[model samples]
Target: MNVFILGLGNVGKALADTLRAQGHHVEGSTTTPAKVESLAQHVDKVHVLRGDESEKLAEASQSADVLVVCVAPDVKKTRTKEEREQHYQQVLEESCKSAANACQRVIFLSSFSVYGDGGEGQEPISESTPTANHDEPSSKYYQRAENHVLASSHGCVLRFPDMYGAPGDLSFSERVKMAIDYFGGNAIFGADAPLYAIHFEDVVASVVHAINEELSGIFNVCDDDNLPASNQQVFDAICAEHGWPALTFLNQIKAPNRKISAAKIYQSGYRVKHPDPNLQYLS
Candidate 1:
């Protein structure tokens, strides 16, 4: 099969490499020309392209058996609430629309943030969970992207948790240090709320699984065994391991404060390599 990835970041690169190893012709796109040569090392071809460019995407992906949207807005590149919202919405919606036009099958990578705070209790979140916090800019943009994807018979949406295990991943230990440096023991993010995570390799595997099985609709792919532990607990554990002081938390009520389960995908024939984030809690 010929696979074309819209973005070639860590997760994208991983999937491209895997597909190539499986005897598929892989092509990837990058926003920067300098990265073209480097990205080509893992795939048959690389394109210098933009997600919102429907014509370019149509041309690049026309021959692809599957078009995967690995592109995500670089929130750091923009300032202001309006700018952030616009960037996210455009990148996601445009990519989905373009991918739908380009190929028979389109896979859009989405975040669990669509659920906002989560289920708030013990029950694991499924694909049907309410994507709360429609008030937030990120949620609004994600929903738009998701809607665009689901609108297509060939499109599918994968809802993932905080993806770790990438080279630049902000792991649990890193978050602990960040709390000390940035918040100065004042508080940890999602201090009192639940947090779920996914490994990068598993992310790649899930995509492959979906493509092989011709999956459609929305699916929540995340760790279930090593599920929701308050960021405060993990932070405290890591801080204690290093003899660091604890931070004060506001004890705020976060919406969508729920654990996510990948059972739907599992039953549909996809399984994650890492279902527990406890390993990060140690490191």
Candidate 2:
């Protein structure tokens, strides 16, 4: 199989490495030219281009059987609401457009932030759940991004929460420290909301499953087999352990408030390698 991955971040690089190890022809993209040599260790070919570079993407993905979009907004560049929305349009929405145009099969790595506190009821967030209707930039642009891919004949959208359990990713403690150092201990997520999350390996597996099964439509990809601790539970422990200020939630739930279900993907024969969120967290 010829696989082309956009945005060679932690997830994209992992996916590229996995696919390459499986004897597939893998091509990947990186915005930084300096990383091309490093990225070549994982992928057969590396294209240097931004996510919004449709022409370059189209050229690079010409022979690709699947185009997996793993582009993430640069957090350092997106501090304000306007900046975030614009960044999403470039990385998520525009990149999906380029992916759909370049490859017949499109798999998008999306965020559970699209669900945005979900509906009023206490039901678990499933594939059938209505997306966010509010103006939150991540939610709005991610929804738009999903639309572009789903418009194709064969498209898969795997929505995940904050992925952890990877050496390259920031630990829950580091995240709390970052919040304190940069954002004045304020958080966008609600304190009481359960932290719906997945392991880094499971995220890669889910994308591979989507490609192997030729899946279409939306699916919530997370560790649904085990219960999760709330933000308060995890953050409080991290703060106390580190002797840092506790994070203050804005009462805005960017993720699922109650529980998030991955039963749809499970029914499709995709099993999560790591299902316990409690084990994954530091707390």
Candidate 3:
């Protein structure tokens, strides 16, 4: 299958490389020309195109057997609520329009943030979990994008949990390091707050499986374990692996906890290569 992956970020690049390694023709698109040189190393071809340009995206989509949109908006940037919403809305509209025109199968990368504040209860969130569009701008934007993709024909929305692995480029360890430097310790959360994670390789496998099966609809692409480890547990794991001091918890932080179930995808006959979260550390 010839797959065109839009947005060559860490996840996108990984997916393209996996497809190419499996003897498929893979092409990738990046917003910057500089990334094209590096992306070409893994994909059969690379295009320097932004997700907002409908014409360029449409042309690229027309040539692909499967179109994957992995673009993510920067949520940390200081911007007005309207400004942030507009940024995501524009990208969602343009990307979906282009894919609808040229691709038979579309995979839109979404986030679990759509399930806003799974507050005060422990529930196994599935693909059918009810979502509320809260005042949070990021959650609203992702909900919009997910809705757009789901409404499209042959579109499969993969709601990914926090992804981490050996790629070493954007691992949780790196983020933890930054947090420690800024706060003088590991970030703390409630002991029961779950940390849903997916290995990078398993993420690629799930996407490839979806493309091959032409499965349409929404699927939660997360590890089977769904270990809801606390922030301290994560810090301990990192410290144990890297030989660092254990972090102290400052205060109990209550976060929205959701146990993402991958049963829907598994029922589709796609096996996950890594079901244990600990295996991610081995890499």
How accurate locally, in lDDT, is each candidate? Answer: 0.77, 0.84, 0.70
Which candidate tops TM-score?
2
Q: Itemize residue pairs with steric clashes in candidate 1.
A: 117-255, 117-256, 117-257, 118-255, 118-256, 118-257, 118-258, 119-258, 120-257
Off by over 4 Å in 3: 74-98, 101-104, 119-123, 180-192, 232-256, 275-283
* Candidate 2 lDDT tens digits, 1-283: 9999998888888898888888889999998999989888989999999778889999999999999999887766665678877887888898998888888789999998888887699778888888984587888889988998999878989998888887667777888898888877888677877876678889999988888788998998876677688888888888887788889987543767788888999999997777665444463
Which 10 successive residues of model 3 have the least lDDT summed? Answer: 249-258
For residues 239-277, could you state the per-residue lDDT of candidate 3 as single tens digits? Answer: 778876766654332334656677899889875666655
Candidate 3 has what TM-score?
A: 0.78
Give me the displacement of residue 20 in model 1, in angstroms: 1.4
* Candidate 1 positional error at 199, Å: 0.9
Each model's TM-score?
0.86, 0.94, 0.78
CA RMSD of all predictions:
3.1, 1.8, 4.4
